[model samples]
Target chain A: MMSARKIIETIDIRKIYGMGEVSVAALDGVSIDIEEGEFVAIMGPSGSGKSTLMHILGCLSRPTSGQYLLDGEDVSRLNKVELAAIRNRKLGFIFQSYNLLTRTTALRNVTLPMVYDRTKEFTPEESDEKASRILEHVGLGERAHHQPHELSGGQQQRVAIARALVNDPVLLIADEPTGNLDSQSGEEIMTLLHRLHQEGATIVMVTHDSEISAHTQRTIHLLDGRVETVVKNGKKKPGKEKVEK
Target chain B: MKPIEAIRIAWEAIAKNKIRSFLTMLGIIIGVAAVIIMVGISAGTEAAIQEQITSLGSNLVFVQSSFTRGRPGQGPQSGGLVFDDSTAIQDEVEGVTAVVVEQYSSETVRVGDVTLEEVEILGTTTGFPSVRDIDIAEGRYFYDLEIERKQKVAVLGSSLAKELFNNESPIGKYITVGSTKLTVIGVLKEKGMVGNTDYDSRVYLPISVVFQKFTPSFFARIMGDSVRMIYVELDEDANLDSVITQIELLLAKRHGVSLEEADFTVTTQQDIIETQESTTAAFRSLLAWVAGVSLIVGGIGIMNIMLVSVTERTREIGIRQAVGATPNDIRIQFLTEALLLSIVGGLIGIVLGVGGAYIFSAFSGMRTVIMVHSILLAFGSAAIVGAFFGYYPANQAAQLDPIDALRYE
Candidate 1:
């Protein structure tokens, strides 16, 4: 494959909790890179710092010390306001709980991101129309006006995905997107993610289930706040290109 | 986020909890209402008193005798205002148009078979009609020539006529006061109550008639027809201050005393109105301070509820932050909710206050005047209170850690 542009690159990132002697390192000198259009999964047991790494990568939190570059621009030292702008313009997130605003209709939930979009790419009417179209594309055309409480777990997750995709983000981070759904619904969600990947959307997922991680092109396994192995399709990748300590 | 979007979000949040929101706004509602109503009643009373003073006459000055010199053990000094003072004011004072010497006594009056006790018997000259703004509904006022001859002619006020004669004409009828027979020469037009002075309840007579019938000849020789008060009318272009000074100097000379030792007090209509207005203004401010306390308590109510709302919606705030909302967006959203609550409450208060004023007047017979500025002031203060009290909770919500908020379940 031709060399791809790096969408995310973390250089020796470290995140410490508390201070002094009792300080705990959640991520210890970890470094990684994700190319454009890559489908990757982060796998780790509880207390392994996978959640902390997801937060840092999502721009929801900053590392204690490190260089994080998104689309080749340093974002590690940016303040909360600048980080929020980057998140609004370039990144999207889906939480494990499908955190849609309660009592809001599905279409409104999908249109929320555009409300904060500073580009003014679409008028309010156009935003509603686009949100409707996306809801149709997600196989919930008739349920656009239904609130989250009225929808099933699978449908709620689909609405969340529609919300995340509304801003045309460069990176989509899903933290166990199907964790709250039943097996059949989880299978459907996996199928939808695969279809999105085929359509050239870069996706990152954090999950504990091996079966869930198996669907990704590459999986990074973490242990004891460090990367334990990098596997490709059940086979180990050749070299650890950027892993430190 | 756009302001419109924040407003919409705030509306939804408030609409979700209708009872609590209304209960929260009750403080503002009562506070604004109190402010409007209290100001309305006080201003109305002031207006009524002002109208009462002005209605007595145009450019009028009142001179009433006051005891300025009296020993601790001895009887009061004999220097007092006499009926001659009115003639001196009319002749000597510049800009003086008319001077009316008046006195009153509570006496039993009998017309035909009807006798009314404690009826006010007023004695004055022919200028009483012009200077006091009184009009004759029928017949005519006692003529000035009648005062020289001490004629036993009288004018009946409209209400006194109604009490004595019912539907019969009181004109040319006989009314007896203190066993002295008098003919009713005129009946006054119906002039309603001005402050506590009811113009339509007194019996008017020529000044000499009252002095001849009520006072002993020896006392008259010494006191020279001593009167109760003098009402002086000035022309339209009169300078009240200079005219008042002239009257003061003239009275001092007539009483054989200096200006400081003068036994009479001179006052214009404006002075009376001003004294009443100052009193009402103090009362208005006292009511405003009381209303302000309730408004402050209302603001605290909003703050308390907003703090609770922020705590309750911690996870919702987290969701908003995850969706790219800045701290300011959250702050604006919550602040807008508080502002909307107060604005709506203020609107309701304005309506209720105005309506309540009218209703209170209708039931209690107290005059109430609603001023436009009071409503605006109440509404403006409500908005300010909402914003002032809303900031802390909104800031607390904005300062919340997004990750920890999300984990708050």
Candidate 2:
């Protein structure tokens, strides 16, 4: 079977640092396409350009030269303000550290993206209701009022996930979503990602762990600022590993 | 981001660090309070001085001998003001209503068993009561006939009357001054202290009686009928400058001197008030400037604390940026926090300053007039300072790179 539409299409994207004397290429001659309903992983060792690719895809940083198409819209040459608007309306991000604001309740953390929603798609009260409902979907309804310090690592990551999905973004970009969690919490998070994938949500995750990559439909492997292989996993399996607490 | 959301976020950040925020606001509080209190006191003193000078009398002019201030033992010179000048101003000047001339002396007085030392005795004409705004409390003042006939008549000031004869009336009582005994016909009303002069402690007598009884100085014998000062009162509709010019010209002719070499100086009540007001205005501005410096220091304190907060919350800012907050939004958030701190501090200072003024006035017995403009100025400057000093740090926070900020420790 073939997907009807491509959610992300990049063409030979490169990110260079320092213009004079000695220059460095963080991303070099790498291009990939992600289908509308696919769960994909980008895996690489340190300095392999996986992080730079993630930053460019997440719209947190612009590539030095490339054409980045998000949902059929070219966004590579957009300015900072336009990029921020695109990020707000179409993309959601999950960091390795579960960067939930400290001293803020889980519900407020979930509602934060909507605060910067310039379109004003929802009133403040509607935003609260929508955030509350999403919190319930992520099994964090009971911990909605708890601050980040009051929640465990897995719960904080769940809050972050709920926040990412609150605006109903077209793509979810998760970078090492389970890196900070224990083995059981990591497995639970993988199961949640699988469920979301089964519900026809597009996900792009960046991680170095092969076991975590096994859970996705496809994996893009990077070595030395370029993609080395694109592996299509045959089927999903219940892979379990006893990670250190 | 919406401004309301930005303000809410700013408020949350400020509330999280309540102690630090309050400490930062302390500078603004003291600065505003100092400004209000200083301006209030200066304004009160100015008002009090105006009231005292106006109380002397309305539409009044004082003509004094140029040499009267310095030449003490010399008494009256040839060019000194004589009693005849008062008559000429009253007759020749068109708008003049009353003229009173006075010569002062200090003498011991005795009434029955009570003896008061160094009582101020004023030898004045009949129009002294109207010209000086003094009224009789119990009995009448001496008439022009009494001065012309050289009658031994005296009027005791209210306080002197009270001192000489406790609760009893001093009307018709006899008081001995030097070797002569004069009958007290009237007691002057109680007028409170103005500057250093105590109107109620004085004794008023007919000028003729003083000239006949008191021994003449060597210069007084040569300059016959020379009085100390002449007070002229004009009608309500009179032009003060024109009347002053008329009296100046008439006096210059009588003293047989050129207009530029006139012996007497003429000054109206308005001139004295203007001079005193300009001095106080300068004093008031100086106090305001000193207070303004403290406000600027307070603004610097806000900038310092805001910079520290920006540095401390770098990661939070990065997260916000990742979540789609624009640089403009970040700038507005921090700017709102700074403005809130100063505005709240300014409001508190206003309350404390007004209350402090009243408390000070009660304890120290000094008048303090809390002007509305002073409060507005303090508050306005506080807001401006917050915005002015807050811009740099807010821009610094806005210029932070999200990638580096997220990775910061």
Candidate 3:
């Protein structure tokens, strides 16, 4: 029997920058498959080609040579407009910088994906209601009317997370979601991600910190445009458990 | 995105930068105002010209003989109207009001010790004043009996009276035109200048006497004996074309020429007025073109400012694109902003330009005529300019790469 699940399968994805003598390969034959309801972290150092891969997965950029299948449909060959539709419907994004429109309220930011999707017409009241509900889910119900600038770094990141989740997309791809926050704010954001994962959200986050990777159930380590290793069910060792406590 | 949301976003964006938006709209304001003001002034001048022409007289016709066969510019050769044609016009034309034959000659006139140099002496019958709509200020004009009996009587223009007689009542006095002496029977009421020619510096006399007394030898040069030009007045109810055709046929037979070779030019006052109106309309259109060019320059200014705005708002565009705004939305937002600016500016300009035109008419003593059609044209052109000039920058804003835009500072 076929399973009704959202899955991303990338086959030998290769992305290159520039050409001729100045050729630089950003992604070199990297392939990974993320199953439904999985919380996976892509960990890599600077210049590890992880962001390029993330950009391709998020539908922001097309891979130079690859087949990216979202739920078994080949999205790699789709046009820009079609890809935009897929991004609107199937993928949600969280950025480290909490990319909210500076002049708009938190509710307006959350309603943006629905606006792009061209779904059921949402009046201002309807958009506000949905945004408030999503904000409530993210523990930010009280800050619905506030602008990004008015919120703390952790709160702003949560707002970004709420905006991403408002569309109820199949995959949440976060690019360095906690990179710009303080350690405590980062921990709170990670806890929120963990709670979202437990609520059956499929998350794929990119981070450079190994400590942050420990929170996720699985970690994919990338080095020099290649996946180095994949660790599944990364529980703490008996000797390291005492130190973590 | 919905159009309402797009409009709201555009409005909000413009509202956020109120000073910039207003400054950008200033170009459209000045352009619309210039077009309206220029058109208004031209219309006013045309109205003034029409008024002046109408004041001269309506349905009054002038016939001047063309010297070179049918060609108009061949000096004044005679084979034209005779004194008998004036009588024939009154007798033959059904709507003929009055007929006055005139022969003009320049001569010096003297009264007492004062001499007026180079004064125009008009030779016509006593019915000239009534036919030409001139009135007497003092004494009385010559009677019909005086004109039939070849009496040497003159009616002095107001300026001529003032120059020769000063403040004294010169009724029953005599003035000498060249070697011919004439009695000053009346002083004409002051008639101001017409088309910059001083009408109030002329004298009038009987046509029979002027021809018999002065320049009797001049008639030997032309075929047939006649007055130089015939001024005819038609009844208000008469069809001008019928009269003109009848007069043309009669004059052709009288002159003993074929229909094509009839030496006289007959025209009605309506012809002169129409010609003046068309000429003024041409001038008005030329002025409108100049004003329209300025509007184009103003539109260019709008385009330039919009381009700058697109550059300045690159990041905002990127943010919108990132969040799901299509390129079409970006284009519409900027275009709508431009249209709104131009529409508001155009309305303001119309008010100001119309008000300015009225003020000019009052202060400068010129007739101002503003037509609704011209106002509509000015406003419509302003909107078109807004759309045409606003399109490129809006398209550029729409075509910006979302990735590059998001990274824009």
On DockQ, the candidate that comes out on top is 2
Alpha carbon lDDT of residue B403, candidate 2?
A: 85
In candidate 3, which residue pairs get closer than 3 Å at backbone N, Cα or C atoms, i.e. clash?
A: none
DockQ of each: 0.61, 0.70, 0.33
In model 1, how large is the Cα lDDT of residue B152? 96
Chain B alone, candidate 2, TM-score of: 0.87
Candidate 2 residues lying further than 4 Å off, grouped into runs, are A236-245, B67-84, B105-123, B145-166, B172-184, B205-216, B224-228, B236-239, B254-257
Q: Per-residue lDDT for A1-245 in model 1, tens only?
A: 45888999999999999999999999998888898887899999999989999998999999999899998989899987887788888888888899998989999999988988877767789999999998887788899999999999999999999898888888999999889999999888877777677677788899998888888879989887888898886422222222211
- Tens digit of per-residue lDDT, candidate 3, span A127-234: 789889999999999988898889899999998899888778889998889999999998889888877877778889998887887777689998889999999755
Candidate 1: lDDT over CA atoms?
0.87
Weakest lDDT window of 10 consecutive positions for candidate 1 chain B: B70-79
lDDT per residue as tens, model 1, B1-409: 8788888888888899999999999999999999999999998888888887787878899999887551212334344788888898999999988899998777899876788898888999989998878889999998889999999999989998999999899888899998889999999999889887788999998989888886435655865777889999898999999999999999887777777766889998888888898899999999988998888899999999999999999998888888788888888988999999888888988999999999989998889999999999999999999999999999999998889988887
Rank by lDDT (best first):
2, 1, 3
lDDT of 2 by residue, B1-409 (tens): 8878888898899899999998888889888998999999999888988998998989899998887333334423254787788889999998988999998888899988899999988999999888778888888999999999999989988889899989898788889987789998999989878767898998899998777777365655655677879999889999888999999899878776666766788988888899999999999999999999999999999999999999999999898888888889889988998998899889988998899889988998778999999999999999999898889989999888888888877
Candidate 1 runs further than 4 Å off: A235-245, B67-76, B91-95, B110-117, B176-181, B209-221, B224-226, B235-239, B253-258, B360-368
Q: Each candidate: how many clashes?
A: 0, 0, 0
lDDT of 2 by residue, A2-73 (tens): 555889999999999898778899889889999888889999999999999999998989999989999999
